[model samples]
Target: MNSRQGALLRALLNAGDYKTAGEYGRELGCSDRTVRSDVKALNAALAREGFHSHVDRQRGAGLRIVVVPDEENRLVRLLGEAEAEMHPRYERLCQEMLALTCHPGPHTADLLARRMFRNKQQIQADLHWWQGVLELSGLSLSLGRYLKVEGPEWTIRGFVMSMLFSFPAPAVRRRILPSLVGSLDPYDRQFLERCIAEMQRDLGFEFSSNAQWQFGVYLCIMVTRIRLGHSLAAWRDAREPGPFFAYLQKRLERHFSMTVSDAEMGLLRDMANCCTWQWSLAAMEAYEPTERARALADAIASALADAFGAPVPDDMRKPLAILLESGLARRGCGLVAPNPNEEAVKYEAMDGACLLSSVLAEVPALVEADLFSPDYARLLLVLFDYLEQVGALRCYRVGLVVNCGIDLALWGAHRIEKLSSRLQVTDVLTENEVAAAAARPGSALAERFDFLVSFEPLDVKFPSVTISPAVSRADIDHIIASVPLWRRGREVRTAWEQEVLPVGPSPEGLFAALHGRLVDEGLVDMPRERFEWLLWTLSIVKDRTLVLAWCGPGVRRTGIRIFRLEEGDGAECGRCTMAAVLVVAPADRGDLTPLTQGFKRLVEDYADTSGAVNDDGFFVCFPDPE
Candidate 1:
């Protein structure tokens, strides 16, 4: 079934009750007669396949899908396979290319086009795009009399494994894996899942559900790629392949009859290396990082300090080294790779992308090199937890000014006071006399506190968060998470007030520019909500080397996105360039309006402890509404 059929089938299956003909038609965006016709075709297809389900219809009730009692799994798999094959253009092309990679062989252009259900021109266009897709995995796609994927043997294997690792888990909300390399050996898949559970227990590091899927698919693919003769050969048993590679090669050599290359063997060992990493800090460091990787780690630490004014503690250097080394294998071999936790880290962990992206900005040349990935963000989070645990991450001093309009509001202020020790409450002033509080502003009280909390909104020159006196446990927990990040909005307001000439790009232009940057920099594609994209776009704010804000259509119309560029070593007030690109990472385009409040909140969080700017200032910006 194609997308239409898949959409229709999914709608029907997801419904708990019968649907009307008009309802089904509306849901599928078709005429009732058309849906009925499609239903007939669907029923025919199901009957032809000997499936135990058919669309049953009642005059008023639209349609109901009845599944056989024990045929649920079978029907689901059938529908999944059918849905995977229905593609429109690029996706279909990608699918065909993947199929070619899986079993590269002789086929004339006419024959290939016929097999792909496309014309010759479409096939050629697909081939063109396929070339670009291959480059991401360090492979080259070439079509001759026979289809062949040409690349260094190691890279070819890497390309395949990376693709395999990217396969969507069966349990994904949408199972979008194309036909090629989509199916898994049931027994092998089970074994790998069990292995992930065992590894998590052994290592004492929890794996998110997604992480387990990543590792399982990666390990399973390694085995499948080997048995299929897509492996490496050992030129020498000694250090040529490295000891880890040699050891893994011996383990797998008996399992596979084909020759395994040193690269392939090395890739397999990296699977363990990644596991060691996810397992525990000490276990990960046991596999020493290469000097180059260690040096890169040092440079990373130094650059973060240089760029963000935050120093990476020296004690955490070893873990950074291990992470860098594992990153090398993941990137180099393109085998089992970790799903980046950038989403959790970006807004959650204090814009974690800053550390890595800053490193890229320092050495612009490394933008396309090994430095940028969601994986980099994950590494930073691990570092952040350790630093916080050791009390290296700085905390802000806060004060509370409670003036209760009601008893509940007063209680909330007390709750804020009773928060964890991370926040050292400098003072708490209970303003029982409203006339006195109104007569005398809390500006001085607000100034004394790094963070200001109040039951009643105070007319203080610093930002004061007015909370209900009766806060819930969850609200308190949220406050705890945010306490360390509490910045007086005044600081961000000041940083933003003194602004540079802003760049505005139309949504289209913004995406195009970002997409261009990704390709030019040889960087992997980012998620749709890419914070790195935001950082890259905002390059106008700081010294990431943009001549001027690439002002497009929106910045003038959209709310301003601001960031602080703290003075670093060799960094002084003499410099003229001042800006940060405020675009989202990786994916090119989306409306920036939704991010306005979030942008203000994050900037405030970043500048929470900056003692500049008046405490009563608002931390928001408004665009010139057209």
Candidate 2:
């Protein structure tokens, strides 16, 4: 149909019940004579479709479509036509409808319908059809019919706004349909849209509907999690590759082929860097210099390229690079040092490099003083160097510093001055104290003096292991069955046995056996401090399955507890005397079946504690130790 005819139909649909020729003419910016002719044409058009329209009027009354067509059929046909048209503007219309349905009020539907070639009845029918389609596609559409109709209103206006901004194409629609359909209401969408818009405006980018939707979905989920007081960062970290990100990646790879240039790669890397930096800053409120930031940037770039299969334009690279370099420099480090004379060039390079150094500093600081090892320090240095090469160092700086109470001058006589400065060591050790400690055999300060850095304490401790309360003996059995060593004659038990059972079977044997099982199953590492902390926690929780005990009248009753490894040393659990309670002795033959059977029972009963119980007790179970 011609645009004029469509416009006329839209006006009619928006007018609702009826309108006199004069009123219709006034609304459409046309004359009464023209309105009357348009009405005649509208009737003729309906007649051709096996439907007829009749206008009726009484004295001092208005004109109305007396015979409304079969609205469902007409709406279905119109939607089909709209779909076939593939007009970009149709997306806007859909968004408006979505918005209207969410907060349906008197003239809201009418206003929306006015944009389409359909009457109010047809508009309502179309809404019903769209809602059904969304449901079929795993979405939900809620109508706001409770409010008065005096003005515009809708139930899910926010959602409509978000959808309009987020779902820009059929492909994006398909990707997000599953997650967003039932989860979002109109209001939620609208609110999310506003958030995304604000974020985009702040970032100085005009995001597409697909981009907006993806971000909105993330924001929505995160906001919900935060509102419920859930672990937001942990949840985000745990989320796997969902359909939206997967699909987007696929599309991006398809667009960018294998022969992508350095410039293109750099651009993609920069964009990813910006996004990662923004997200990290928003979530962490802190920045670090290291391969982690670069890796994140690379991941985003690689995913985008792999999905689109097209090289990014050279034009896009410069701006992104500038942003990455600037952000990194402000944070602390960059790959290349910018020229001093060139304000723009130097700032770009130095920013990334500085950011990197800052971030690298944090790794050592997070390490516990007693548990600090040369290996950890080495790992941090390696990570720092890697970050420098990839240009991720520009994102932020690490603020961690070693706090030695005294200056390095006190150790001058020992020629350890360089060691002190090289390690960022603060001389908490006085000159006389160091000399006196050096004379002692195996002094308390000697062993742990190498790594004495400390981190800011957090209210909640980080989770060392992920355990499920739902874990049962069956799960443990499955794990046990997979161990080759557990199978007779499969492998010889030797010095390695000490790795699992440091003191051998009695109580020590049990502890080692459980420790080996956990490590074999990839539930923990071989760090002694980590093991001690976990053991302490397990002791506090008193998991009958994890604790093995032998008690008799005169014999030293021994208890062996199993625990996961943590980051710090035994210092955290120094108050717990579970280690002292362990008994080491020759392998005894007393009631082995009872010990095994009791453990099995405990494993079966191990249920992860929920809510407040989680804070006070160890509710998680390691995978089955077969």
Candidate 3:
């Protein structure tokens, strides 16, 4: 069960059928004598388990576990022995060697190299070693060369089990158990139990594996989060007395025969309450109104007390009252009124609204317009309803531009703005600069106007219009000039329109306009040759706008065509055209094919159909016109 023996067995397993002692020695980075000794030790261990190891001298020479005993049991016994006998540091080293390489950013490789004082070659070797180990366990490790680590089922299970044993104390185990088991599914649990059972039966060692402890911690965190809002008060007042927590506790005790102490339960309740209050307050401050926040706080507190095993903290009750008063004082609910003129305030509000809308929109069953309310509690209820509709909320921490004036803008935005500013000074303007200047009139020195506007209608909607090719800069300037007011006007008009009209529901009518002007003798017939070429060229033009007028958001039209032109010599000249049209919609659309796959499939289908065209002397292959 030593490292050397395990290494030999791994080599044999990897080699499949069999391997010579010399081959095994070379792979293990050891001498032939060492390999022989390792084989002998492994065979002895196998013999003890009522399995025989045989080396066929005449059959091309390689040791094999002739009586392939239950592999699951063998692995378990090996793991138990390794755990019992291996030095802590040696065990750590083994784990490290078996660790999957995480896709670290460009800087990560260098950072890890520097920290470990190991070269890139060594790191790569370790990655290979881990991959080999995982292969033995019917698992795979995928590390994005520059991003993240994704371990397969068995590998992940093994890592979790290792982590469980690695903890020195029960408190540490309790703290980490949730993180360890939270990501596992039923299959993972079964695999883990198999590994544990194998170890117990073969090695005569009991694994201190507690499914209840693992599940309890997971349920506790979620239950606490549910009863508490993502605010300061929610975090503070989060207690374990919510019905969900109580139910979870009962389930755990019934299933595992383990009892949770009153003291531990109290502490857990307090922690949940505190977390709940804190998050609730933060969420309220960010999005909800005073009255709504107060109501939400009450609802969450009551929910927590009724379901979980603990009551809301007394301090949280006082703060909730104070928050309500403060909210009312600031606005009607002690919340400050939104300031559109202030860059920070305007951007924050817009960003928050966009985020909230996106989160709610993901839930197909929830009506986003109906969810907006002045009351905090009602808003929270709506948010929860949306989350429930969506089945789950994946919480991710992302950096927000608290002060964009100070923060470096994203590359595309910065580049566009920089080019526009340079174009204002230069005589020769770039295409990008011209586009930017058209979007925002005047030089960058001029006061920037807020483009966002809110309207009081049955449903919240943003005014949007597609730019027509015919619209001139002067025409746009005249429209801007006509509208004296910059804020929400009584009329719905673009920066280019003349007379503003009251904003109405989104228009469903489609308007078609020609881009080019007609001559005095209008509508002249185009030459057949020119028209034919133009139509032929259209096959190559993958622009979605030209192909389909009403493509859904984020959807693009792409296809392939094969054109066969027969010459007088009875020979055919063919051209294969693969076209891809990229369409980015003005708003988010739920269903859209990825651009790459869409193009690839279009080309593949076109090629397949084109190859089977009729033997008519002249042939043109195209997709179904409709």
**Root-mean-square deviation per candidate:** 14.1, 31.7, 30.1
How many clashing residue pairs appear in each of the predictions shown?
Answer: 43, 82, 55
Better of 1 and 3 by lDDT: 1
Each prediction's TM-score versus the true structure = 0.54, 0.19, 0.23
- lDDT per residue for candidate 1 within 1-626, as digits (tens), equals 55566666766776745888777665555677977887888888889989878889887676888987876677766665553244334245435655565543565567678877878887776666556556645677767676667776556655554444332334222432434335455554565566566655654556656556555545655665565656655422124655534654564565444465665655555555554446454455444677766887777677666744667777677777777777766655555443435434544343323324434444432333343344555566656654445443344565566654456544554565466434555666665432254357453443455556655666644545555555655455444443432343333211123232322222233335444443334332444344344443232211111211211222222223332222334231112222223433322112221232244354433322211111000000111111
Q: TM-score winner between 2 and 3, please give it.
A: 3
**TM match of model 3 to true structure:** 0.23
Each model's C-alpha lDDT? 0.49, 0.34, 0.32
Q: Rank by TM-score, descending?
A: 1, 3, 2
| CA shift of 574, model 2, Å | 78
Q: After superposition, how far is residue 288 of candidate 2 from its true place, in Å?
A: 24
